[model samples]
Target: MSLFAAETRIVRDQAGRSVRVPANPRRVVALAPSVTEIVFALKQESRLVGATQFSDYPPEADRLPKVGSYIRLDLEKITALGPDLCIAVKDGNPVDVVSRLEMLNIPVYAVDPRSLDTVMAAILSIGDLLNAAEAASSMVADMKGRVSRIRQLASGAKERPGVFFQIGVSPIVSVGTPTFLHELIESAGGRNLAAGDTPYPRFSREQVLALAPEILIITSMARGELFQKVKEEWMGWRELPAVRNRRVHILDSDVLDRPGPRMADGLAQLFDIIHPDLAGKY
Candidate 1:
C-alpha cells in the first residue's frame, strides 16, 4: 500500500455503509449496561460523560450522570448533557424516543448485534465509531479466544444433558431457540428441552413436568429473590429427574441473560454446571 493510502482513513459498517467519526469523541452516553460495558471495553471510558441508571459496569461507569432507563429516556435530560455520541440498542430503546432525539439533532447509533460473533463485531463497530478500533478489536479477540477454548474443552465430554432454562419461576419461562442464551446453553453441551414453536413463550407446569428435564436452570433477576427458594422448590417433585438428581441450579441474570462481552463467561458458567471436572476451569 502507498503511504498516502496507508494514512488514509476508511470508516464503514459491516453492512458497507460509510460512517463519519470524530477524532476524539468526548461526552458520550450509553443507554444500557450491556451496551455500556461494550463502550468501556473499547477503551472510551474517559470520553464517556453520562450513562443510564442501570449502566453500571467498569466501576467508573457508575460515576457518570444517570441518563434514565433505556426504555424511558429523558429527552430533556439527554439534550441537556450535550453528548457528542450516544450508544443505544434497537430493541431496548423506544423508536419514538430515538426519533425525538434525532429530531433534536442528537447523534444516536442504534445497534442490535445478536449472537457471539455479531456481539464482537458490534464491539469493534463501536470502536470504529469512536476511532478506537485497535482497543475494541483486542477486547473482542480475547472473548473469541475464550469461546474457542470452551468449545475445545467440551468436545470430548460425555452425552450432553437435556437442559431446561427457566427465565422465570412464578410464570414458567425457558430459554427458547433464537435467543442467544439458548445458543449459549447449547454451546455448554446441553440440549434445550423447550424446543419447538416456543421462543421465550409462556409455559405451564404440566408442560415442564412432561419434558422431564435432566437439568433445570433458573436465571436470577436484578436484586430479587434469585436463589434456591424458587429453584429448590422442585425438591418436592421427587418424580422429576432433575429434582431427584439434584441438578437444579440458579444463575445470575447478568451472567446468563445479558448478551455482553461476558457471554463467554456465561457459557463457561453453563459448562461448569453441566460438567463436574470442567467446573471453575473456564
Candidate 2:
C-alpha cells in the first residue's frame, strides 16, 4: 500500500451516517455532473465507468454510459454495469434510489456540499477516494488561489452592488444564504437579497420588493420563449432598482449551476456583473 492510501480515512456523510469503503476506489460511477467533473479533474477518467445524464463537461463525459438523472436513476442498468463504487449527491438524487442501491450492496455513497468550503472538502474527498489526492491537493490550492485573488480585487471596490438572482419570474424567486449561488453573490462583492432559507427555495414578489436590489442576474439554460419570458417580465418590473439602473443581465445556467471546475469562472462573471470595477484588475 502507498503512503497516501495508508493515511486515508473515511468520514461520515452530510446525513451523519458512518460507512466504510476504500480510501481510493477504482471502477467509479458518478451519479451527478459535479462529481463527474471532479473525477475528471483528478485525471482519473480511466477509472470512470459510468455517469449521470447531464455529465457533459470535459466533453468525453458525454461519451460514457449515462445512468439517467439522479431523480430517476435506473437501478437495474447501474447494477448491470457493475461499477466498483458509486457517488451521488446528498439531496440532488432521490433517496429511494440510494436505498435500493444500498439493498443491492452497490456501495453507493452520498455527499452534500452546499457552501464553498463544503464544495472544496467534497472535491478533496472525491480525489482522495479515487486515489488522486495529489490532484485534489493541487486543484484545491489552485481554486483557493483564484478565490483569494477575487476577494482581494473585490475588497478594493468602491461600490458593491446588491444582487437579485432571478430563478423564476412569475413567482419572483431569488437566492439565499444557504445556496452556493448566495456565496457567488458574496464572492462578487454583492449582497444577495433573497435568504434562500435553504439551498434553492421559492420567493414571492413582496419579499423581492422589500430588498430593492441594484443588479438582477437571471440564469438561463436556453434562449427561446423561456428566455423571452424571463427578460420581458423582469424588464417589466419598472420599480426595481436593477430595472431602473439597466443592470439586468442573463447568465449561463450550466456554467454557473453545475458546481464544477468552472466555479471560478462563474464567480468571475458574477464579479463582473456586480462590480464592473473589478474587471480592470483581471
Candidate 3:
C-alpha cells in the first residue's frame, strides 16, 4: 500500500461503493446543500473546506468556499480547495464528477438519503467518518422520539385528511410515492392525493379540483409572491373542502424537501397542519 493508503481506511458509502476515506479528514468538501447541512449539524463544519451553492442553511455555510451547484460541480474550484475528502449525495451530485474526482485520488464518500430512516443513517455514517458518532446518535434518538410521538398521536385520529401538496408551479407538480414528502404527509395522518409510480407528477387544475383534497399544502421555494398567487387561485374554488374550511397552507420548501436534521422539525410542522386538532397535544 502507498503511504497515503496506509493513513486511510476503507468504508462503504450509501451507494454501495468502497471508499478509502482519510483517518481524519481535516479538509472536506460537501458536494450538496443537504450534505453541508448534515456536516454542520454534526458540529464538523470546522473541517469543511468547501461547500456547494445554496448551502445556505445555518447561515454560516454561506461563508464557506463554494464549488458550484450540486448538479453541476466545478471540478477546478473543488481541486483548488484541496479537500482531502468530498461528501456527495448519490441522487443530487453528478456521477461523472465523482468518477473524475476519484481518478484524481480525492476520496469521495457518497450518501443516498431518500427517507427519514435513510437520512438518519446518513447522519450516523457521516458522523463516524468525521469522528462525531456520539452527536449523530443523540440526534437520531431525538428524531426517533419525535417520530414515535407523532405516529402515536396520529393513530388516534378517526379520519386521514386528503392532502394535496403542490411542490411546483406553472405546470403544477406534486410529489408521488417515492418522495419524502409523501411519507411526511402520510405519517402526519394525511393521505397524499398524488401518490403514484411517478416521483413527481404534473397535474392540471381540473384534475386537482376533481381530487377534492380536504387540505391543500403548497411548499414555496423563494417564490413568496407566486405562492400567494397560487393560494389565491386555489381559494377561488369555493366548492373545494380546503377552500371552504380555510385549510390551505404554505410551507417552506426546504423543511420538507431537504433530507437533514430539520426533517423532524418538518414532520412536526406537517403534523400540525394535517391534524390541527391534535397539534399541541403532541
Question: What clash count goes with each model?
Answer: 0, 2, 0
Over 232-276, each residue of candidate 2 has an lDDT whose tens digit, in order, gives: 777898998988889988887776777767787888888888877
**Model 3 TM-score, 2 decimals:** 0.96
Model 3 agreement with the true structure over 39-120: per-residue lDDT tens digits: 9999999999999998999899999999999999999999999889999999988999999999999999999999999999
Q: After superposition, how far is residue 259 of candidate 2 from its true place, in Å?
A: 2.4
Off by over 4 Å in 2: 1-15, 22-24, 196-210, 220-225, 236-239, 280-282
Candidates in order, TM-scores: namely 0.88, 0.86, 0.96
Judged by lDDT, which candidate is best?
A: 3
Judging by TM-score, tell me the better candidate of 1 and 2: 1
How many clashing residue pairs, candidate 1?
A: 0
| lDDT score for residue 104 of model 1 | 72
Candidate 1 error regions (>4 Å): 1-20, 280-282
lDDT of each: 0.76, 0.78, 0.92
lDDT of 3 at 92: 80
Question: How close to the true structure is residue 169 of candidate 2, measured as C-alpha lDDT?
Answer: 58
